[model samples]
Target: MDEQRKKGLEKMNEVYGWEMPNIEGDPYFDLTVDHLFGSIWTRPGLSMRDKRLLTLAAVTAQGRQDLGEVQVNAALFNEEFTEEELKEVAIFLTQYVGFPLGSGLNGTVSKVVAKRRKAAEKGAGEDKRANVNAAVKMNTGTSLDDE
Candidate 1:
């Protein structure tokens, strides 16, 4: 196994407490890692930060909050994103995507941010409702036409 695969597997077991067995004996091992994660995902053109953003978007588009949360947490751990970044992603999702997906993603992102911020003893922040409303207005180009 190359160093990155070994390290990822080890970290998965240690931090996440899950053992990922080798699907194949040896030949496929390095190939699998290289093609899937290393070659494709680690392409030099896109910065790690941009990859994280696209990943979050793909997960959000798929409406897979569980997988999305896993990636989001990883991004945070890797310093690929911050709590504010998560919020902005969710806001963008709300604007172009549908409200349901947006809300669901926002909820998951909020929980992660809150937990992480609390762990870091950072000050709490406002809820996403305000941001959502603003996004709706922006997307619709409306002033509410208050009567």
Candidate 2:
């Protein structure tokens, strides 16, 4: 198993207080997570904004707001999408996903934005107090939340 998948499963287990039964019995497990998200998502062609928009649509259509919220945070905080960009994605989602989903999307986006911005400011203050020179060199090229 890839460490990424292992770590994801670990987190799930920790949260739910039980290991999610392995879906390896189903052959699509590896292909879905590994080939799709792991490989295709990491490719350079799609911008993070596009990915987040896609994720928002998919999650809303499928009624998976928890996952969507995480992706929203990844896009806004980790991928450095501006507030306008995030709003655009949420607005666009309404066309295919409907108004109710759009409202949930708005709430999810707002919640993540507030939480992440506060966390970032706190981290910055902590870094400043610690005199961590590396904090000054922000690597904005990629998502930092996953690692």
Candidate 3:
């Protein structure tokens, strides 16, 4: 990766919670990281989460379920959206995007939601144990809800 694409890939992976795959020798993939992610996505006017939501809308409207898979997974893993809110967005998009396209996108979102929630719940349990251990050494009682 070139310097700019490397930095863009790192930041995007951080936000998405997964390393986006690079296509070796593909100029298009290079351009995606260099231009779309590095330049356009880093614009100060809109937050990353907001940009993901808008991208979801655009992808759904165009019936691009493949891209939707990545965006929805990013949104869920990043906690940019709650499951209910994501479902609501799908329903809302039905009018503008049509039922077939919106429903297609929602199917991908639902799959990612389940997977992300399962991983998060497991991590939460481990985190609670660590917090409890720390609190014990400090002689301070900590409630799970306090976090």
In model 2, where is the ten-residue run with the lowest total lDDT? 130-139
Across 50-102, the per-residue lDDT of candidate 1 in tens digits comes to 87788778878889887676666666656677877887888888887788888
Cα lDDT computed for each candidate against the true fold: 0.61, 0.56, 0.70
Query: Compared to the true structure, candidate 3 yields what TM-score?
Result: 0.71
- Which RMSD values do the candidates have, in order? 15.0, 11.7, 13.3
**TM-score, one value per model:** 0.60, 0.55, 0.71
RMSD of 2: 11.7
lDDT of 2 by residue, 52-134 (tens): 56767888777777766656655654455776777777788788788888778778888877775786888742122111121
lDDT of 3 by residue, 33-132 (tens): 6777777777799887788889989989999786776677667667898778888889999889899998987798787666657768887522334323
Q: Model 3 residue 129 lDDT?
A: 41
Clashes of 2: 0
Kindly indicate the candidate among 2 and 3 with the higher lDDT.
Answer: 3
lDDT of 3 at 82: 78
**How well does candidate 1 score on lDDT at residue 136?**
28
**Model 1 CA lDDT for position 32:** 44
Q: Among these predicted structures, which one has the highest TM-score?
A: 3
Q: In angstroms, how far off is 68's CA in candidate 3?
A: 1.1
